[model samples]
Target chain A: MAIAQAPPRERARPARAPRTPYVLIAPAVIAMLAFLVYPMASVVYYSLQHYNVSKPWDNAFAGLDNFRTLLFDDPLFWQSLAFSAKWVVTEVALQLVFGLALALIVNETFIGRAVSRALVFSPWAVSGVLTTGIWVLLYNPTTGVSRYLADLGLMNYGAAPLANPDTVFWAAVLAELWRGVPFFAILLLADLQTVSRDLYEAASVDGASRLRRFLHITLPHLKDAIILSTLLRAVWEFNNVDLLYTLTGGGPAHQTTTLPLYVATTAAQSHNFGYGSALTTAAFLILTFFSIAYLRLSKFGAR
Target chain B: MMTTQTTGRTLDRPALPEPVRLPRRRHRRRSAQRVARWQIYVPLGLYLLFTLVPFYWMLVFAVRPRGSDSLLPWPITLENFDTVWNGLGFGIFFQNSLMVGVASLIATTVIALSGGYALARYNFRGRQLFMIAMLCTQFIPGAMMLIPLFEIFRTLGLVNTLWSLVIAETVFQLPLSLILISGFIRNIPMELEEAAWVDGCSRLRGFFAVVLPMLRPALVAVGSFAFIHSWNNFLFALMFVSEQEKFTVPVGLAYTLGEFSVDFGALAAGGVVAALPVVLVFAVIQRYLVQGMSAGAVKG
Candidate 1:
């Protein structure tokens, strides 16, 4: 049938094509499917059923009930959602402000500049577990630096940092910031390096004050970097339940139970895979929204 | 921006004419330079204090006996180190952590090496989609995958095994490794491969013979990142691997605290043991890590 209407161009196309590239990538594709895609898809399936851990094979289909329960019924779920949002907002905001300030200050030449850069960026090299562990020790109410300070009449040890529900959120925030600020600083500094010296020189000649120059030139140039950094950090902070897991175990009556921890606690510890998977889906949906929103905003801003 | 005006010198200081405005530019410039210098020093000094003091205290507390109530007291003891080795399984935990880290590193790097090369060199139809898939995978929190992964392992009869930890870590590192390696491959000139092909080598051979050697910096960077990530991973190791003998350092150290409740010195010692490998690894390849981090931002 093709012979009657076949074009000369179609006849010129080669019958056999190259195969090495796909062959080279076959193992990788298999591994990714086995490890990345399979498990994720399995979770989605798990979310649809109520399976008892003790009786692995026996299960009943729950359909969308788990999702409904999480969205409408779980008060702890909503609490954690609020807590997660607050955590990301406060953490990202403070990191940006302080990190930008740090970049500006460290951008100049001075005594101990190398030493300072080393010190500031050094924290970035420390692993997250170590950072969380250090803070956990520091936040220990009975035997920590807080107690020492209180003994010296500097503050009240009775006001426990991680135990008090009111301050526990801030405590988690501080721990996250301690680890994340270096990331913000380095990114901003890298961006700041691209700003031409001539702009600053021109601004100086025009009698623009330092603050005015910063407001006009520095901030505007930093806009893209700031947004990107904030987005990247927001995703990280959203998913980072490890810090809370190590330091507080999401305790003080679950005051520090951010979304990820809540999901994990529900799924693994409580052995409710259906509810846990639903919460996981919920968190992923929120992150997907942020990602889409960022993409749209960036495109809009670029235009 | 400062403008200068030349002034004539006079014997015994001539009377100045209304403090020449242009000449003041030089003095103002100097003042601005002074302020800039101060601005730079303050933050650096503060950062130094913030980053190093905690580490110093970590070291200090690890060495000091539990009897020393003074927070700032300085004289060190070897007793904690002794107890860490004898009373606790720091040695065993360290070995397990090393095993898990190396296993995950090798597994992820192998998968990423091929995947990254394919993404870099090939013009496949699903390439962009694959890249986007990787980005999405990165955003899926490890917690989200934990239970399902546990169930899968349970069904496969792989729970409480080090291989389970390795598999979980390798999955997490694969995306990051691929991104870094792809960027690295793009930076390398394709002419080297072309030249190799002209010598009658197949595309696969050309890649191995020519491209692989040049990827050293990226390999060091990605390998270190994968290793450190695997080393420091605690939650999975905690929840998935329940056997004491199978425990990685972080989980093992956490368990030490509970088992040896008031043995603060031993617990501190275990913590110290756990932290040393990463510090040494970071110190050895810090420059590569920085390059990796900046590259990550570009790709992230």
Candidate 2:
């Protein structure tokens, strides 16, 4: 068959190479399928069955029983869900504002700009568990910033921010913002460079103030990047459990427990696979719905 | 198109040049630009304090002699580094983390390159579906998949192995890497490859000769992301590998954070150890990050 074919046309892979794309995508698809899709399917499947590792004798198919318990009887689920919403909203909003401001500031060419950008953005590489470690050292009552503040006759002594319910939320927020803001800054600053300087020059020629030029030119141009980064960051904050797990451990009556954190504790500590899977499924649905609704409401990519 | 010049926000001065004083207009504008210098520095200085103090505190704790309460890192000692590295076994964890990070980087880059190429150049059946499915996978939480992944690893007899971390990290990192790389490949002109073919080169040869060089920034961004995420991954390493020797850096750091012996110096030392490579990698790759995002992400 090859002898009859044209030699020049058959050089690449012959006529049977039509499935090259499939072959190329095979490894990624296989890995994702084995790890991502398979586990997700199993999570749903396990959610319907009583699959606690410690209590094997009592195991049985649970159906909607776990869902029933979660919906009607589980106050922890609702509380964590509420906290998850609040956490995502607060973190996303604050990170965006501060990140945008920081990006604009650093985007302007000035003396010491390079060093400032490097210093301000350095925390991004630190790990979450390590972030918890650093913050724990700083949050310690006697040896931390509060101690120094007390020496200066500023803040009172013996104030444990992590232990107090009123202060833990802000403390965690501060630590996370230290890391999260840099992400938005990098993304937005990238987009900011692409903004045509001609627009700003034109606005200035039209006697527009700097604030007016920024409002009319910079912010509108950054819309898509803002929307996408915020959405991605929101999903990430919802799913990420490292900081909360190591920082507060969702303690002081689980005040900081997000839904994913709750699901992790349910699975890791209690070993209740059935209910944990149920909680996992619920969280997945909520994320999907929220993401779609958010994109729709924000009119992302609508121009 | 409205250009309302309100001086309210930039209210550094109350007096303005009279419209009749046309010659003073240039001077007024120059002064306005000059006076705005503090606008950038003042806030940036405050933020730099927010950013650097914690790191300084970490350094102080890591190196300061034990029981020294002074803010300065004077009379520094190597005791904490010695304790964590030799005594607490972070040395082993560091080697393990390096191995896992590099392995995951290689695996993710290779797989994502091929997959991204397919998505970039081909319009095959189910291509859109494949892309959508990959995006959807981002919503799946790593914590939620802990139980099933543990079971899978157990069946594979990979429990307490560094390969498990490598595999898990590569799997989670592939989707985003693929998306980003595909976007990058789309930006490269298709004519380059076609011209290579016209010059008697095969597709593979053309890719190696033409496409690969232009893909350097994208490769750096993707590779660095893979390494950093794999290095920083905590929950999977915490869940999948339980043996002390097999533990990665984050797991080691988590132990230092636990309710056991609270050695601040050792913990901070271990943190410094964990933060070193990624911070270096970030420093090298961050310049490409902005360029990569502008080309691949913002437009898309």
Candidate 3:
């Protein structure tokens, strides 16, 4: 029934003018041009110059010099890039696993479904800084959960996860997972609701176990949604600088900085527009490359 | 509109039952469904603890007397709220945030509605290209855009103004909202608009009289999305607004967080302020979330 929503090509001889679409699209197009497109073009332009805000005299075209320094000499650049990869992989994988489980559980026709769904999905609304704020209170050594546990004779009191380089990654991961899982759960649940109950009914009659039914039927049905959401989540986790920036300040010694965090710190603090722009361009290219290959390898939407 | 398509009932039964014992088997399946209640609830209960504790912790810190380390909030004080609101300048920040959030909500929704109408209804030149361009923008890391966006805003003398935040938020919000809203407008059967036209309503009048009413859920979904995103936008607000008076909630929270001797009370209080509007918005529009998401999911 809903497939009837496809645009009716046969009704093309309409009373509407062709310009109506353009007119409707004008505001959006103009905004994107002025803000998104123009700024993007200028990022490429700035990457070629030495335009630090502190030194106007140094503002000259540097060609590939910025990229050269980034590729060859910058240890922090490579470190941050590697961390970004690790961060994205860990966040996306964990979020999907837990999120899928949560989505499946909530998809059942159980008691208190509405209220439970609302409670579980609540974290998706919390912003990154707010997330950091909440977790900071939880992770603050003296005033945090560990102190309580220690006072109850459960563990040592002075172990602050965010202050330690070894545990900081997982510390940030858990906090991010709180918010990230709900996004996948919501998307997967939407896709889950569309799976025809008759398919399950037929499988049940065929004496298929629940596990086999999920493997054979539900998995294939959710294939597209899973792929699409995971890809989007991967990119989002890569770009999200708010939580780490606020929580760790990208440090207890630069152990937690993602590439974008580096770019933001560079741009905001050191006023290194040219080098930051170069890093920005590199990150954009990497994302675009990774996305194209990921989509291609996954054979997304082909069915 | 979508709910009608999901529910199954006896009216859908064929002239002959698909299998002779189908009714009996369905009852067995219903009993089987009853068997898994604990499987659903026990783990859900644990996960809910994981989810709700952080929220509860924030509330506890925000209201508990400043030096009392009591686990459960009792004999709550308004001191933290007062500190962040009046003493810490969040009162000004909240006003700024609301102004930015609402302005961008209006801007993003109005522009997206029009652009979405085009994408949904009238196929035209460069339509596919436009859609592709919008999708590609998703991969452009927003954090990376700080340098160039700052440059553009500086050029326009808008670096410290709230308008810079509004414009940046609206632009980023546009791509997804446009696609989602277009997907929604597509799902509203064009026949409804055509029928209105046949009844002597002009196209615009037909849209207002018929289609717009049906679009309430989608509009709310899209509008609230814009509002939530704008409100939560941290980096742009932080980067653009250096003046404390111009700060949004996130920037204020970031400063509160950055201090070595962080005021847990004030930080938690500010966290509550940041969380309040979006949570309320989420609560209201969440019923439509699955439906709204499914439309976009089906499209792309």
Candidate 4:
């Protein structure tokens, strides 16, 4: 009893060193805040006030007008925002599914798996400009693959995909998908390795069929990965300009013009600085919401 | 999906305990495997074929004669290459892209390695908040920073300079690099560094000698990523640089097409020339890129 009492007395005699992980992380924090937070704060400030590009220094405070215009008065803004919604959802969903399916097949220990993965990953190396160029060539009316198909009694009208306003959006989406799918394939393959083979073996032993096992085990296990992958890709898709710009330059009649292209056209090409900044500010908020909601949602289920 | 599964499993799995029937079951299983293999190959083969056709077309366009009307029926010639070399300033643009890509890679990699190392090794204050903030940087749309970034560069008298594009691309490169490297650093056990420290090496020396070598894979990953990001950068280059000589490949190629439309041959030639380095670099360092992307995405 005396020995135990003495041990307790010694243990309680000195307090543990205070845990301070923040001290180590200060540099990254400062770098981020300086580069990211400061810019974001400035964006908010600019959005609230009337910011003129030509007369940048002549700052005037215009409370909610910028937001009002962005929301209700601007049809292009709404159209572009709506396009982004459809754009990210359709692009990301199909890319993820196709990528996952491809990854699953390639992940198998089959002949030529390495070559297959390499071939698929080749597109990831090609620049946005090259991908767009190839697609544009394919969509050419006179001498492209589409025309060839039409000549062979396969396709109808032979109208180029990019030139058709109603179809231009899908054309842009496909171009983006060609670039985007490899991302999911690569990332999903990574997560797939982290899943232990023992789990599959055990499930199979329990007479769980592959389909049931995939749904209950693989899908559930891939939750964190799926959410993270989708979010990252969505953020990218929201900001992506090269694919859309190269494919259609916002399109036959602004059908494929995304928020980024719109902002670029407005500020740089059109020289409407104040309104452009206002529109850019709106785009930032929308993207910010996408990111924050994603983070919070993922964080909630991250156990 | 359900029918495919049912068929696959029925043709693949069987549960029985019999000695004399073993050879028959084994024979049956062998033929079933063959059938299953074909089924798997069909869809995958078609997808691969569909995906690669465009790249095939690109190659065709690149190598064919300049005046060839048929993009498909091609007598492959070096004439297109010659035209691209002579007419489009392909050599100059190629050199500029390499310079900018390498510079951004070096700058971003150095900063990320040091910063990521510091964050990983020390159990200090504000680490979580710092990481979250780093992530927050990626959250904001890249286009949002265009005007402000352009304004800053203009004020600093960096417009129309390669320095402006380099810095802008570097800024774009930094957050992702840091984030990716941080994950790799965290994988390295602290005991390794501690052992070096106990052997009389200073913290900085331990980092350089001990930690840096272990970070080779992550370095390769981040370097390749930085290279690609810089190479593909169009918006910043378009906004910042106005001089013809200062143009990077993407912006230069984009400009090949004016208001009326594109010049396909010249654009195709430029595209081919521009993509060559990318393909070469990828072929050499693809292992690292895959490793890095997978590693980065997992932690993220």
The candidate that achieves the highest DockQ relative to the unseen native structure: 3
Q: Candidate 4: list runs displaced more than 4 Å.
A: A1-37, A54-59, A156-158, A295-303, B1-35, B67-74, B259-261, B297-300
The share of true interface contacts that also appear in candidate 4 amounts to 0.36
- Summarize candidate 3's per-residue lDDT along A1-303 as a digit string, tens digits: 122244454373255576787988999999999999998999999998898999888899999999999999999999999999999999999999999999999988877999999889989988999999999899989778899999999999798999888899899999999999999999999888888778877786676777888899888998888998999999999998999988888997899999999999999889989999999999999999999899899988777
Put down candidate 1 lDDT per residue, B1-300, tens digits, no spaces: 323212222122365444555555433443345344456666667866776766765676688877787666368788888776655766777888899999988988888888787767666556667777877886788889888788778888889999888888888888768877877776667777777878999777988899899887678878887898889888888778988878888886666544534455565667678778877776666556545544443422
lDDT of each: 0.73, 0.87, 0.87, 0.72
- Supply the TM-score of chain A against the true chain A for every candidate structure: 0.86, 0.93, 0.96, 0.83
Indicate the residue-level lDDT of B63 in model 3. Answer: 92
Give the top-scoring candidate (TM-score).
Answer: 3
Tens digits of per-residue lDDT, candidate 4, A47-130, equal: 777777667676688888887888888899988888888888999999999889877776666688777877776677776777
True-vs-predicted CA distance for residue B178, candidate 2, Å: 0.8
**Range of the 10 consecutive residues with the lowest summed lDDT in candidate 3 chain B:** B1-10
Off by over 4 Å in 3: A1-6, A13-16, B1-35, B298-300
**Residue lDDT tens for model 2, B1-300:** 222232433345556545456644543454335325788999999999999999888999999988888899998899999999999999999999999999999999999999988777776677777877987998998899999999999999999999999999999999888887887877787878888989999888998899889888889988999999999999999999888999999999998888476888898899899988998998788888878777764556
* Superposed Cα deviation of residue A248, candidate 4 (Å): 1.4
RMSD values, in order shown: 7.3, 6.6, 5.0, 6.8
Model 1 residue B231 CA deviation in Å:
0.9
Off by over 4 Å in 2: A1-16, B1-35
DockQ of each: 0.31, 0.41, 0.51, 0.31
